[model samples]
Target: MADDKKVLDDGELVLVKDYVEEIITDLKYSTEDNFTLKVIYNYSDAYLRYGTVKKLKKAQEIFKKKGYRIKIWDAYRTVEAQRFMWEIYPDDDFVADPNIGFSNHNRGTAVDVTLVDEAGNELKMPTGFDDFEAVMNYDPEDEKNKERTENASMLNEIMTSCGFRRSTTEWWHFNDTDKYPVVEGFNSII
Candidate 1:
């Protein structure tokens, strides 16, 4: 571990499902469904900084009232996992370069999420998760992408309103405004 990095204990990180039961979690990195096409995580639970989880819980409450739910795709990635993803994608826009610095997800203060309907079906967005072509800030005036833009906009609005900063490149990625040091030694396993 670098001198600048901190090792967060389990107390500082909480399982997303434990914090917000209604929010669905599909940890894509735990399976071969992600861009890496390999399981990057040994466990499947999504974890985030406790403060970040609180914001997500608030977002989930708001979504519940609006007949939608949050589905988390990724959270709290280890530096090893980050390196593996970088090797596969090698795109700084999508995957953070561990050599330069760790990602917010490595700090447990960022998450990849999408909005799902009451039936747990994901809403139509500009593109699927980890799709590099997906732009977070799409042209709302473009009629061809009206529904996709609207859905992405709604998700962005709610997530940002709950104290998360939206990623300009990825529609599904959000970072907590409250900063936390890059964490080390934590894995997806319980």
Candidate 2:
């Protein structure tokens, strides 16, 4: 991980694993298993702005005390990647339009995450990653949705308290607002 330690400290974009230990990364865009059914990202690593990394480090410390950790699904997307994703999903509520406003992820200030137990298994949430249903909203009121909602509520409480904004539709998405840079090419920063 020497190269990781060297190249990953870019002030504009740094891999989350550099500061957040044991943070599992599931780069959805780097595989065919995603909504696109094709690889989007050329590489697989959760990269965010350095400032975001420091904020996440704080969040991880808090989660660690609670016997939980963050598992990341995706982070640091290029506009080209977003365009390809839009071609497949095309839902503005979920996929941001590359032609218009930039995605928070493109800014290296956003992350898609879920809480995991000490054993490293993700806690049960309202829906799995990429689930766009209304029930996937952070908290649902139905008794059947209690565990899921409570789990999401817990994530919301932790991330928000740590300075990350929760997404209204995707329970797993969060943004570190103060350090947003909004970019078009993921490699441009490198």
Give the best candidate by lDDT.
1
Candidate 1 lDDT, tens digit per residue, 74-172?
Answer: 999988889998888888888899999989999999999999999989998888898775454556688998998899989999999999999878889
TM-score against truth, every candidate? 0.89, 0.88
Q: Each model's C-alpha lDDT?
A: 0.86, 0.80
Between which residue pairs do clashes occur in model 1? none
In the predicted model 2, the residue pairs found to clash are: none
User: Lowest summed lDDT over 10 consecutive residues: which window, candidate 2?
Assistant: 1-10
lDDT of 2 by residue, 1-190 (tens): 3243455443567767766766788888789877677999787878888878877878888888999988888888887888888888888989898888878888888899998998888898988888776444444767888888888888899889888999877888998867655764456334
The backbone clash count of each candidate, in order, is 0, 0
Instruction: Report lDDT (Cα) of residue 153, candidate 1.
Output: 89
Query: Which parts of model 2 are misplaced by more than 4 Å?
Result: 1-11, 134-139, 188-190
Lowest summed lDDT across 10 adjacent residues in model 1 is found at 1-10
